[model samples]
Target: MPSMFGRTTKKLVKEIGDQELRPVKCLVSATKIRRFSLIQRKKARSRFWQLPDVPLDVSLMHILEPGSSVPDAAVEVSADFSDTEVMKQQAAGSVNAGAEAGFSEETAVCRGSSLEYQIVSTPHETWTELQKRKLPDPEPYFLKQCREAGVNLYVVTETVELRNSPVLQDHSSMNISGKFSIPLNIFVKGEGQGGGLKVREKKLTVPKGSVVAYKRKQLVFKEKDWGIHHIAEDDDQETFPAGRVQKALGLGADFKLLQEEVSQKVKAAELSKDMQNIVFSNLLAMLGDREALQDLMDKLEQEPFGHLDGPGGTILTELQKDSCYSGVVSKCLILYLLETLMVLSDIQHVLLAQSMEKRILLPQRDLVRSILEPNFNCSENTPFTLQPELLAPLQGEALAITYGLLDECGLKMELNSPRSTWDPEAKEPLCALYGALSVLSQLAEA
Candidate 1:
């Protein structure tokens, strides 16, 4: 039995040796050994902290120095051992060298083109030194251009009261407020390239209340034109209509036959002989009597013809009373006498003289009113009929008076007469003459 047991054990040992041995079971598992190995690695890693290598030889003073250059140092390190390991070691050595030279891993791998830099310094200079530099003069060029273009610049200093402002249905004349300005330059265009050229520039302030006349953008100075002198003053002086009659009769060169002509015209009219004689005698008396003229002037001075009331207590009184000329004769007769007086050359001379003496400009309507007050005692539309025989002589006489006045004032310029001239400065006298003649013409036609 012992022999058989020994053989059996040997066979079993051989079988066991020939076949794979089975692992023995334990209380601890394979999973537990792996978990313990991982724990040990974590603890070893946490025990020691890794830090970036810094060079001890480099000093802070060397880095802060201006215009200083530092040389880059190279390092080599490798762990791989193979046939291709040399190439890998070479790359690793380059990376380590770049890192030691203060370059990041990304910057070392991805190299870019070299960059260049320039340094600039701050400037130090005073503003006064900069302004002292030479500059071009512009005043000469500006004044030259002004001279070439004949441009004038005037500053208006004052504005005075306006006269003869336009009324409804009246377009012949307009008087704007006086605009005064002192000329800064008087530039006249040269004749024949540069003949008779004068440029005067004076800086002067116009006196207060000095009237200016603006015509077509040109300034009219009173000292240059005598006609405008009347416009520069206020209208306060009274005009004497009888003075016109007295002058006409006293200077009877052409007026000696004026009474005879008027008488002949009145005798041929469709009026009674007595009415003609009455009209004739009253006109003669007005011409001969100086006291009558003085009385009329006193009455005119006391109250303007326009402000007088009629006999019937109303403006439109049928039977005239308390009037200077209305109670003398019929309205037709008064109209005839007015026509006769308005035609006198002496009347024009007297009016012009008075205007100059008083330095006052009278309107044409006022001039007409001085001769004959409107018959407020009649209807507003009442018509006064003069003898048809009298119309021609009256119109001719009015024309003669107008031309005479224009000539006496030295305003007759054939084609460029002051009578035809229109401007704000000359408007005063021009309007007066035009208005008076226009009324007389209308009366003669009526």
Candidate 2:
């Protein structure tokens, strides 16, 4: 190193010594692109997004103050705060306990879990009033069983809930039926305190003169000396449901069309029901059980069902695929007839198995109606040919069957002309099929 004349200084100054930004020699080498050292195991604990594990011996919340054994803990924010606004406290344990702040008994819930909120809502702090988050006391599991046993939960006709709700019915009924038109609370027979699934509408038919257990909804009312006032929910507030906010701002006209379009789409999705059938009755009955259904299916796979070079072969293949694809099982004597019906006119493969899922019990007519568009025209005098032997099988089944209209006198169908829609006197292809089923049911009974 050549020094100019006398000497060169050993130190450099003013370089990188500003605002604690001075560079230093590496304890660890500089990372190559993203390939750095692996994350440490313990660093996840300090993250705000991670919920800290509760101590086995203590509560996660500081619910119990230092020396209070009985838990006389009370907390209140400075204002009503446009509903309970949970801003993190800059200073903890700073309570204005001297001023005796007022809040409803429900606010105790808000005070306890507001710190670790599972959910936060604005229109209503709905969960703040709940004691705990769990299934509702009147669960749907038992109700479904009751429905299967020919009992239904019935209540006052005028009760309107915005969504599907399980009205609590009396579980302790001595018989399947209970007294009708009883007060809702009496119908329920027990009072419960909990939260669970929400209610929506389902189809329930209440028979005339039949007994039903009364069902009651969970409702809150504040009974004051002046009157029994209903605590109504202001859910329709803001710019959406009530539309008052939009009207006030003079933008209602602009948004009305958009709102209508949105409403239509939402309603369509909600109302739509999947139209598919699961159980094909004839095969299941013949096989004796679902286990046999599989055994027969395996046998058919191995033996190939006696030279299926015809339409029957195609039907068998489709049936096998359908059975395998769905959680439900279905099968055939009428496969050839189905082929014929299809050849003569347009028909949905209602007899075939579903690729994904099918409704357990879709009537043949419903399956047909699914594909029948509004402008769909029916084929007149649609020729249908059936093996005369099928009639004998239908008669056998109709006799064996004891329930439904098949057993009644004068149940008849004629295949003169078929249409897309049903008429009281018009005959169609389904008439023969149903007529056959009726005969089978009757013969089985005999």
Candidate 3:
């Protein structure tokens, strides 16, 4: 291009400078936005919150030295913090440690890996005295478990001093009561621990029994020490229900108001026997001991049985027929009833089936049929009518109670013309008839 206009180029070069004119050619280009570039990382930040705040500087000095073994370490700050006074205490002895020299928002970074800490405490002659012994690295150990199990560890340090300024009067037992204020340092670590991370601490009152065991992801609140009592053998005749059922039953509706008011009232009365048996059965289930079940079965058998009015017959009858109570039985009728009802109740279908065949020595088909059979049914030999012929032999009040119970159980039946088809609407009086007879039998037996 300069060749086409040599005179213009020469004139321009001469006006500017010879040296500048010698390097005239140039190239230019444009680029789109390139936002990111790769670089090596020097420090890494924690992906989650930092560990709880502990006075490691003050406490570690007494137990661990600076040259401790560690690998792959990092630190980050968290929003959690400790009491200002505790910060001061920790800072006093934190000069030589890696701790920050002054008060800052940066808290301890949790070491991610598990740190093995040994127990170092001042020994005492008595176990109670051990409570007073200052523990080394107690906060760290407690905090480590808290983080691993995902819980909170609260530390409270209380000082107890024996004062000798009391007046010794002629009193057998002296009672000194007064209000005094003492400082308490509460350190609440963040929910978790490991790599030294941000720790949150708070100041609060220490309630008795607040501390609990953290095991298998469970937090058990501390319990008072009541004297231990061994569970009595089922045969000992001392088995007692915990009374939850009895409490539930006693709170049931009032029945006397039902007659005139036709209002809501509990149709069923609380059976002391049923509640006791259920509670006993629950306790046995918790034990999960086959031996315990067998023991209960043996105890149940040995228990006396007579008429319903007798001392132990009702309870014995209930227990004897509960398939849950498994053991040797001199009579097969009780076992058969238990095995059949358990299946029908859907409590343990498979287990009951296997038990009936293998343990109780009954055919599976028969047991299943017995369970499926309706509680009340027409005589198989007769047509559809109030089948009083098929009803279990009951007399007087027993018959009345039987009818009432069946009615409550939803077995509505009707006694129609013997020659005509049975209508359920006509069955109400027939039910009343049987109810009277059943009740009479029960009253006589009672």
Candidate 4:
């Protein structure tokens, strides 16, 4: 039974081998195969993948035909061929792109070639040749014509001579000799006056110890005479009073000392005595000297308001005839002191340091605004009204103080509605507001 099974297996294997070796039938026509091969060849010859050096093989074309029996091998070869063509197209595209970019760059560089070359190379030889060329000297004929026209064609040279004078003489003499050279006209071919070559000599003898005096006439105009008159000069000369040297007090001087000095100046026979006294007194009151300031305030409060002369005949009473005088004086005093403190660097430091310990009461915001307001009546000189005469100078002082303080402190505070509270947090800003208001007030007055 085993021998029979072996023989059957051998016969089945031989049959299977015969079936596997059988040939396949072609479905596509020869025309289609020829057309497909022609298309592929045309594509291969196109500009995208041109290969003129390598010719297509007839045998390979024939194998690539559609109706060929070896479909698997043909399909694989066509795939590889398509891949190679795609790779060639990509390489050609990259090469063209690179060439275009390079061409553009080269074109740009060539555009300004002349200018770029000139800038890079030095023209030292050309410059040297230009420097070597000398300008021709002026022609004699031109000079002759200039002299004939009275144009003065001569160069004047001066020489200084130092000589010792006789000791018995009252004065010394300095001899200054000048030489004038008149060039002869070479173009005219002659010399002398007719040829425009002429020389003139001049000598001046200034006598030593000689005194010349002339009476100086005064240019005066009389009411009777319409024209100006030259009258005899008057011997009297008008003299102006000297200004106060506030700097003598020094920036670091004590507040009391400054007050005393200011008081002394105010009491002295000086111009604007009343104004000076009021201004200084107000300044003293503002320096945070509570005891002194309070005493003054109490005295002012005790005085009769309406009458010019009260029981004590106080300064406040004298000023109180004008209702605005008290407020204005106080305001001006504060402004003045603020300015003085700002001007003195040392004093500013002291004030800033002391500000931390003793905070001074600031004037009411409304009162400050009223004084600083532009439209407020400056023309009125009636009782209780601000004197128009004093307004301008007070305003100027205020503005100056404001500027100085702002510059020194470098503080930017709102001026329109300043914080009037005397709290530590508000002190610096309050001071800054005072300055800003002063500036604004001056502007309004202007």
Best by TM-score: 1
In model 1, the runs with Cα more than 4 Å from the true position are 1-294, 300-401, 415-426, 438-446
Which prediction has more favorable lDDT, 1 or 2?
1
Q: Lowest lDDT 10-mer window, candidate 2?
A: 4-13
- C-alpha lDDT of candidate 3 relative to the true structure: 0.23
> Residues 110-152, candidate 1, lDDT per residue (tens digit)?
1111111111111123212322322223323432332333322
Reference-based TM-score of each model:
0.19, 0.15, 0.16, 0.16
lDDT of residue 413 for candidate 1: 18
Which stretches of model 4 miss by more than 4 angstroms?
A: 1-273, 285-288, 301-317, 320-446
lDDT of 2 by residue, 355-398 (tens): 01222122322222222222123333233322233322222112
Alpha carbon lDDT of residue 30, candidate 4?
Answer: 11
3 or 4, greater by lDDT: 4
The C-alpha stretches of model 2 lying farther than 4 A from their native spots are 1-208, 211-371, 374-414, 418-446
Quantify all predictions' global Cα lDDT against the true fold.
0.24, 0.21, 0.23, 0.25
Could you tell which candidate, 1 or 3, scores higher by TM-score?
Answer: 1
Candidate 3: residue 436 Cα off by (Å): 21
Give the per-residue Cα lDDT of candidate 2 at 332. 29
